[model samples]
Target chain A: MNIRYPNGTAYHQSAKRPATTMSQTTNYGDRGMSLEAELNESNQYYLNQGVAVIHKKPTPVQIVKVDYPKRSAATIKEAYFRQPSTTDYNGVYQGYYLDFDAKETKNKTSFPLKNFHAHQIAHLRACVAAGGIGFAIIRFTDDVATFLLPASFLFHCWDDALQTDGRKSIRRSAIEAHGYQINPALNPLVPYLNAVDQLITATKK
Target chain B: MNIRYPNGTAYHQSAKRPATTMSQTTNYGDRGMSLEAELNESNQYYLNQGVAVIHKKPTPVQIVKVDYPKRSAATIKEAYFRQPSTTDYNGVYQGYYLDFDAKETKNKTSFPLKNFHAHQIAHLRACVAAGGIGFAIIRFTDDVATFLLPASFLFHCWDDALQTDGRKSIRRSAIEAHGYQINPALNPLVPYLNAVDQLITATKK
Candidate 1:
C-alpha cells in the first residue's frame, strides 16, 4: 500500500529497512509501523486521555510554482522539501513545553550521530536554554526498541563528536545507561510519556 | 510580487485587504505584510534575543501526487491545503508553554467571531487546560492595532456567540476592555511578549 505524507511525499516501509536485512514475519510491538506513526498514535491517546496536548508539525515544503484553475482549488506544480529548523513534534504537557523528534536506526550495537542534523541539534539546544524540555525518541529497528534521550545528553554527544578523535556514534550500552528506554504498549504503541515523566523529574532536580 | 508560503501556497497581500476599501497611501507599521509575517519577525527577534523560542507552524498541505524523476529532485504535481488542527504559533517562553494564532480584520467596529475556526478555539482550550498559556494576537488593519486576548476570554466569547441571542461578533470596545493592546515596535514589530508577561502574571494569581 502506498502511504503518502501530508506533503504528498511517498513513504515506503520496505525502503526504511536496511537493504541487507531479509523480511521477517515476526512483529515486535507493531514493528511494521514507523516510529513517527507510533508516536502520533501515542500522542493521540494522550490527548484523548487529557494527559497532554501534543502534535506533529506538518512537513515543511518550499513551494516554488503553482497554477490557479478557474472555479477549482489551486494546484502546486513545483515544490521541494525544506530542511526543518525545529523538531517534528512539540506541545504542552503538564505546563512543560515538550519538543522532540523521532528517529529510527537499524544498527544493532549503536546509533549513528549522522541521524541528527546540526540545525535540529541547535534548535533543541535553544529550546533547552529557553526552559523547554527537548528530547529525541530513537528507535532501533533491529529489535523494535525505542529510547527517549534527553537533549542535554544529546548535546554532550553532539559536541563530543566534533572533536578530532571523537567517536562518530553512541554505543548502545551508553544509551542504555544514560537514556530512558521506552517500552512499547498497546494503547499508545510507544508509551513515551512514561519515560518523559522520568525526564521531567530529573530536570526538577 | 508573488509570495509563496512554506507549503508553496501563494499569498497575495491585495487579496487579503477588503475589496471595498481604497488602498491608503500611508503605511501603518508595514501595512502590506500579513499578520503572520509580522509575528514571524517578532518570533525571530525573540529567538535571537534569547527571550523566547517560538515558531509559526508550516502550512499544512495534503499532497495527492508527486513524480520522482531519475537524478532530479522530486516534483510535487498535485496537493491541497488541509485545515490545521492547531494554532499557527507555539513555543516555550520562560518555562511557559505558549500557543496562539494571529488574526487580522478590516471591520472597524468589531472583530468577527467568524474569523476563528472551531478547531483553533478547541485546541487553545485544550492547551489552556494543560496549563499552557493560550491567546490570540488580533490585528485591526485600519489603525494597525494589535491586541493579545487570552484564550480564557476567547472561550467566553466563542461560547457566547453559540447562544441564540448572543452577538455574532466581539465589539472593539470589549476587545479594548479585555485584551491587552500591543504597540508596534521597531525591533520586533509586534512586541507581544510584554503582553504575554502580563498573562503569565495573571495565571500565577
Candidate 2:
C-alpha cells in the first residue's frame, strides 16, 4: 500500500502551486518535482476543469507470485516487467487521440536518439497511421526548456540515423526550428497542450 | 522471467483461430481464453490491420521491494495495488477517445451492477463529460453473449440504484434493448468495434 521511490523516498502527490510569478524566484530543479510529476499534476488540472481526459499509463509488471495472507488482502511476492513500454502518456484531446512520451535530457546541444526505443517508435508510428496525434515532449533539463516534437519529424530523424553515420541526436537547433517550444505556467505548469494546438493547426494546413 | 497464472499454468498469447464456424462445435469458455484475452486478441487484430489504436492499460502495481542482481534485469520482490483502477482499456479510435471495461458474469437474467466499482463509474462519468466515448462490454458467460452498454445508459442505472433502490442489476432485456450486441468473429475474435461503430452512429443521431 505504501509506494516509495527506488531511494526509499515516499511518493506523495505534488502539492498544488499558487498561480503567481514565483517562476523567477523558485529554482524548479531544486523544487524536488520531476517533469513526469508536473505533467501528472497538469493532467489532473485538465481532468478537473473538463478540458481534457489524458492519463499516464501505468508501468506494466508481470506478477509471478502472490501471497494470500488474509482473505481481504493479497500481496504480490515477485514480478518483472512484461516489456519495454510504448509511451508515458496517451488519451483524448478535442477528439484527437494524443500519444506522447516525455523525456528529460541533461545534454544542452541535442536530444539523444538513444533515449527512445524501437518499440516506442513503432508504437508511435502505428498510432499516427491510425489517425492519432503522436509526439514527444522533450525537456532540456539544464535550461528548464521543453519542446513538443511531432512524430513525423521524429521519424525523419530516426530514419536519418539508420541511413547515415551522422549524430544520433536531434540537434537543439533542429528541435527549436521543427518543434514547438512550451513555456512553463502556473496553472498547467508545462502548458504543452498549447503546443499540441499549434501542431493540430499545422496539420490542417 | 517466466510468467504463470495463479493455478501454475504457463501464459501464452491466445492463438489466432482459423476462420471457421466452430461456435457450434467448439466450447470457447473451456478453451481457457477469458473475455479480456479475446478482446486483447481482437485489439491486436485491429492494430495489425491499421484500423484503430487501442490498448488495455496495465494493472498498476506498487512495488515495495526490487532485487537488482544483475544490472540489466530487476525483479520486483514485493508489491501491491496502489488503488482500484479506472477501466480496463482506453485509446483513440477514428478521432474518438474510447474508454471501456470488459466484464463477464455467470448470471443469466441480469448483468450485476456490483461487477463495477464506484471509482470506475466516476471515471467513466468524467471521461464522458470531457467528450470521450465511454462504455462497458458485458459478457453473459452462461449464453456466451457480449453487449456494449453505453456510459449514458450506465449512469442512469447507477443513479437509479441510489434514488429508487430498484433491481441493482440491469436486466438482460434492458441491456438487449439499450446496448449493441457484439457477434464473435474469427479475425477480430469479439469484433466489439462493430458495436462501437453502432454506438458512435447512435450518438450522432
Candidate 3:
C-alpha cells in the first residue's frame, strides 16, 4: 500500500537500495548532500578512528497501535512524532560532554532565528550552566558553508532580537565574525571536531 | 482493527485511560513498578528540581510504511524494532556524561549476563574509554533491591565468563560487595544519583 510521511511526501520503501547508490544520488555540485547526512558520515569516520563517541538521538515517536504476527517480532501500525525536548545530537568527546543541533538554510545572507525553538534554547542554556559544551552547526546551503556557532553567541543574538526591533536572523557577516568555520574533508566529510577543538581552546583562554 | 505486541499480548487501545488508573494497576504490593517506569518518574523529578538533566532515549523503530488517511496526521502502518547500539539512557549530569541501562530479573541470587548484549557491553566500554561514566542499574525483582553496578566490574565478569567455565551471571554476594546499593525515596523515587555521587567520588580517588 502507498504511504505518506509527516511532511505529506510519499514514503518510498528503499529497503533494497544500496548505501553507495543513495550517496551517489545527491546533487553534489549545488547542494553537496544534506548537512545531516554529512554529519552522520563524519561521525562514523570519527568512531572508526577512535576519536569520539557521538550519536544522533533517535527521532521520538509516540506509538498508538502495534501488531504482532508472532511472539518474536512486532510491527507498529500507528505512531506519530513526539516533539523532542533536547538537541539532535549529544555524546562524550575527548572527556567533554557535547550537545548541539545542525540546521541548513538556502538563505544566503543570514541564518534565521526561526530555525531554533525556545525550549531548545533553554536546553542549551541549561547544558552550558551544567558545564557541558553547547553549540549549533549552521549550514548556508547556498554556498555549502558551515559554521560552528557557540551557544553563548546565539543566546546573545536571541535576547537582542527579543528586546529590540533588530533583525531576527543572524547576518552572514556576524556568523563569520563570531563562529568558527568547519572545513570539509574526504575521510570525514564535515570535520566539525576541528571546530570543536577551537571551541575548547577558546574556552580555556 | 485489533493488534498484538511482541509478547503475544493483545494491544488494548487505551486512548481514554486515565493516568492515575494505569499507575494503580501495576500490582504495586509485590513489585512496586517496572524499573523503566520508576526511572522515568525519577528522571522527571530530577528535572523538576533542577538536580540533573537525564533522559531515556526513545525506543528505536524502523518504519516501513505510514498512512495519512485525510492528509492531517500520519499513522505508521508497518514498523519493526531496530537493535539499539547503545544504552537506553544517556545525559549530562553535573558536568559528567552518564550512560546506563536499567534491567530487572526475577532471579534473586544472580543477575544473568545474558540480559546484556555484546554490542551494549562494547558501547559501554567505549563510553568509559571516552571518559564518560558507564553503569547498569540492576533491579532484583524478587526483593525489589537495586544496585548501581560499575561497567568496569561488569567488563571483567564478561571477559572472564567467556574465557573460563565460570558462572555466567553475577552472584548476589558479588554484586552486594562490588556495587553501590541504591535506596529508593519518596521525591526522587529511585534516588540513584546519590549512588552516582559516590561513584564520582570514588573515581576522583
Candidate 4:
C-alpha cells in the first residue's frame, strides 16, 4: 500500500500477505522501511494503546534566513542541519524516563562504535546518572535482528574503545551476550519495551 | 555585555550589580531575557551540578526542498514550521519523570487559556497519566513573577474553560493559591527545582 509520512516521504508497504489465517505468528520483517520508520510506527502503536509516551525528537536545523511574504506563510530560505546534543528518542514509560537512539548497520559480524557521537554518549551518561533508563536500539540490517544495549554496558565498551589497545568496534557476539535481543513482531513492529521491563526489574534487584 | 545564543540571537544581561554581600538574598529579576532563556540558563546550571537532565526539544520544521552544492553542506531551500506534538521540555530529576512547558503573558489580572494549544494540553495529560510529573512555568511579565502550575490543576482549568458558562482565563489569585511561586536567583536564574521538590513531596503525601 502507498503511504506518506508526516515529512512527505512516500513509502510502499510490502504487498506480500500471509497465506494462513493466523496473524499473531506472522513476521513483518523489515517491510522496506528504515529503522526510524519502524520505530515511529511502533511508538504510535504504544501511544494509541496508552502503553507509553515516547517520541523521536525532530532533526535539529539551523535557519539562517526566512522570507515572509505579505499574505503567505514564512518560508525558510536558508538553513542547514545541526548536530544534535542528545539521543534521538526520549519519553516517559511507566514512571521511568526512557532515553535512547536507534542505529542500523549493514555489517554482518559487528556494530561499529563510530556510529555514535561523543555528545550523545555524554548525554546518555548524564541521563543515566540522574536516575533515568538509557539504552541503544541497534539493528543488524543483514538479518533485521535488533538488540537493546543498556547504557552501563555501552559506557564500558565506549571507555574501552578510548583505551590505547582497545578494539574499534563491538563484536556481535559481545552484543548478543550483553544486550537484550528484541524480536520483530506483527504489532508494534519492534517490541523493545518488553526488554525495558527486564532492565527495570534488574535495576531494582 | 552582548552575549549570543546558539541560535544567533543577541542577549544583554543587566549591568546593575547586586550591592549586597549576601548572594542568597539577591534577586536577579528577569535579567532582560525571555522566559525560555531563563529556563535554559537554569537547566544548564542543573546540568552542570548533576542535579537534573532536562532539555528543550528543538523546534520542528518541515523541509520541502534542499540544495547540496559540491564541497559544502546541504542547504534547505524551502521549509515551514511544524506544530509540536508534545511539551517543550522534559527530563529526569531524582528518579521522577518531569515534563513541562514555559509560557509568559503580560496580563496583570489573569493568565489567558488561549496561550495554550489543545495538543499541548493533551500531551501533558498523557504524560501525567503515564505517571510523569507535568507542569507549566507561567511568568507574569507585568511584575516578572513566575509560578509552576501542575498538570492536574491545568486539567481542571482546561475542562472548566470548555464548559458553556465557564470563564476563559485563570485568575492570578487562583494561580497564586494553587501553584508554587518560583523566585529568580543569581546562580540558576530561575531556582524552580526547589518548587519541584515540593511537588514531589506533595505527590508522595
Candidate 5:
C-alpha cells in the first residue's frame, strides 16, 4: 500500500532557510497552501466568531544542533521527527471533543493506504474507544471534494492490512457512502467547523 | 494568583542549558519534552492499559538553517516557534474530552504569570466554553507535586496580570482549593491520566 504523490513528490526535506511553499520546493507532490496554514486561518476564524475551538497540532521536531548567528532566530541546522503524530487537530467543538487528521491525496479514485502510519491508526482506535469523536478529513484533489471519514472506518481498513489479499486504498465510493462531505467556504477556508456543528447536532440526538 | 514551581525558583532566561532532568534542551521560559514525546508516551500507555487516547499537535517549524554533516543525521541548527501552540494535550478519557497544558515550574510558593502565553490562555477559554474539560498541570519541583487547575481559574489569574499590584502568581492554597493534585508514578511519568479518572468519577456521579 503505497500512497504516491501526483508526480513522485517525496516527503519534503525542510531546508535551512524558509524558502517557498512545498510546491516551489518540489512540484511533484501537488502541494499547495500547507494544511497547517489553512487550519491556522480557520482557527482564527473560529476564535473571532466564538463559534468553535480548533487548532492544528505542531509538528514535533527534535532539535539537535543550534547555531547562534546573531543572537536572534536560533538556526536549527539539524533535527529529526520526534515521533509520528497521531492526528492533525483535536479540540472541543460545540460540546464534544473533536479529533481528526486532514490530508489531501492527488489520486482520483482512492486514497493510498501508505498515507497513514500504523501508529496513527492505533491512536485513532484508542481515541474512539475513549469516546472522543475521531475522524479523518480526506481531500480528493481530483474531484476537489473533502469528506470526513470517521476513524472507525479507517481503522477497520487499516486492520485489513493483516489479510493476505489486503487492499491499498480507500475508494471514492466508500468515502461517498460513509463520509460526511465537506465543501470549502470563504471565512473559515476549510469550513470544517460547520461540519463539526452538523455532526454534533446529529450525534446529540 | 500565579502558580509557582516546587523549589520557588523564579523563571530566569537560560544563559546556558541547565543540567536538570530534561529530555534534550529547554529554557527557563519553555518547558521541555517537546510536548510530542510526552504525548506519544502517554498515548502508548493509554493503548496498553486502555486508559485514554491523546496526542500532541504538529507545528510547522520555520527552519532557518540546517547542516547535513552526515547523511543519516540531519542537524537542525536554526528553528523558531512558528505559531503559538494551543495546548499541550487533548484527548478523550472515559467519556469526557480533556484538554490541558502540562507545565513544570521550579517555584515553590507560587507559579508565575510569565510561563503562559496569551494565545494559550485564549485557546483554553474557547475549549472550556465548548464543554471540554480544560485545565492545566503545574509541577512544583520543590515539592514534587503537580496540580491540575481548571481553565476557569487560569482565566481569572492570567487576566489579573494588569490589576496594578496584581497577584502575579497562583498561591499553593488556591491550587489546593481548586485543582486536582497528581502524584507521579513509575509507569507514567506525569500520571495525569489518574487525575482524569478522579474528574470523570466525580462528574459521572
Candidate 6:
C-alpha cells in the first residue's frame, strides 16, 4: 500500500480530550485553532481573491445525555462515533467540485492508515465516482512539508492494506510520485488550490 | 415572500451540554449538533442512501497570529473573518445539485434576515441561476418548527427589508405560503429530499 504524508505532520487531533466538565476551562477555538480554523481563514482569502470555495466539514457528533447544569441542563455524559467521515474540506473551485481531507501526523516517516477509517475511504470513493475532485492535504510538521494527494492514491493504499498490514504507511517517496508538495505562506498554509489547478491541468492532459 | 417550518421544534438543545470538542456523542444527533453538524450527518445519510451528495461549504478564516502556547502550541490567539461564505451546505442530489443553509432561532414569530449575510444571498442567487436547488432551513425554537424556504423567498425578504427599516425577519405566515414544511422524523428530521421530490413533482405538473 502506498500512503504518502509530505514530511509527516499531525493531521487530525485525537478524538478524545480532557473532559469538559473535568477541567474544561480552555477555549480552544479562541486560542488554538484547528485545521478547520486555518482552512477557514484560507478559504476566506480565496473567496476575497476569487480563487475557490472551500470549507472544513463539521465533525459528526451524537448527543447522548444532557445534564442542564443550570436550566441549560442536558450535559452529555456519553455518546460515541456514528461512523468515520469521508474528507475534511471540500467545495467548488472554478466550476468544478473539490473534496479533500487535512491530516497531521507526529510520525516523521510515513502516514498510517489508522488515520483514515474504512467508512471515510468509502466516502472518498463515492465522491470520486460522482465526478468530484477528491484529495488530501498532508502535513509533516517536523519538516514542514505539506502535499496534496489524490483520492485514487488514497483508495489504493486503503484497499491494499486491508489484506496485508506490513506497509501500513505511505512513504515520502510514494507521496512525491503521486502528490504535489505545497508550501505554507501568509494565507492558505498549504496553498492547495494551486495543486488543484495542476491536478485539473494534469487530468485534462 | 414566504417561508415555513413544517417540522415543528426548531433546532434546540438537542445536543447535550456542555458540548464535546469533537464527534457526535449521543442518540440525539440533530438537536445539540451545530448547523454544520446536522448538515454533515444528513449529507452522509443522503449519500449512503443514494439521496444526495451535499457538503458544508467551509468558512473563510483569517489567521492573524499563531500563538505558541507551548512547544506544541494548541492555541490560536488572533484571527478574524476573512471572506463571507456563499452558502452553508451544497451537493448533488437526485441529479440536481443543491445548496442551502440551516439556521436556528430562539424567536418564534419571524426569522431575522440579519442572521443571513449578504454574500450568502448572492451565492444562492448564483446557484439558482446555475440551475441548482437553493433553500434554507429556518428552525424556530420557540415554535418548534423548521421550514425549507426557497432562496427566492429569502431574496424577496432581503429586498423588501432594504426598502424599509420595517423589519428584517421572515414572518411565519409568509414562510408557510412560500416554503414547504418539513415534518420531523427520526431518520432525517430535515428530510429535505422528500420536499425536493415534491418540488420535482410540482415542476413536472
Between prediction 4 and prediction 6, the one with superior DockQ is 4
**Model 6 over residues A1-205: C-alpha lDDT tens digits?**
3343322223233334322323324322223345556677888787666666555654443434333467552334433333435567666666566777888776787888788877667766777766777888877655556788988888888777777655788987888789998766677544778888888899889
Better of 2 and 3 by TM-score: 2
Q: Supply the TM-score of chain A against the true chain A for every candidate structure.
A: 0.87, 0.85, 0.84, 0.86, 0.75, 0.73
Better of 5 and 6 by lDDT: 5
Given candidate 2, what's the lDDT at residue B149? 97
Instruction: For candidate 5, write residues A156-193 as lDDT tens digits.
Output: 77778668888778888998887788777767777876
| Tens digits of per-residue lDDT for model 2, A63-140 | 889998966677999899888457879877777889999999999999999999998999999888878899999988
Off by over 4 Å in 2: A1-30, B1-25, B28-30
Sorted on TM-score, highest at the top, how do the candidates line up? 1, 4, 2, 3, 5, 6
Q: What local lDDT does model 4 show for residue B48? A: 93
TM-score of each: 0.88, 0.86, 0.85, 0.88, 0.75, 0.58
Which of candidates 4 and 5 reaches a greater TM-score? 4
The residue pairs that clash in candidate 3, if any, are none
Compare candidates 3 and 6 on DockQ and give the better one: 3
lDDT for model 4, on a 0 to 1 scale?
0.88
Indicate the worst ten consecutive residues by lDDT in candidate 3 chain B: B3-12
Q: Distance from true position, residue A105, model 6, in Å? A: 3.0
Among these predicted structures, which one has the highest lDDT? 4
Model 4: chain A TM-score against the true structure: 0.86
lDDT of 4 by residue, A112-184 (tens): 9999999999999999999999999999886788999999999999999999998778899999998999988
What is the Å distance of residue A188 in model 2 from its true position? 1.6
In every candidate, how many clashes are there?
Answer: 1, 0, 0, 0, 44, 58
DockQ of predicted model 6: 0.07
> Which stretches in model 3 have alpha-carbon errors above 4 Å?
A1-32, B1-31, B69-71
In order, the Cα lDDT scores of the candidates are 0.86, 0.83, 0.83, 0.88, 0.71, 0.66
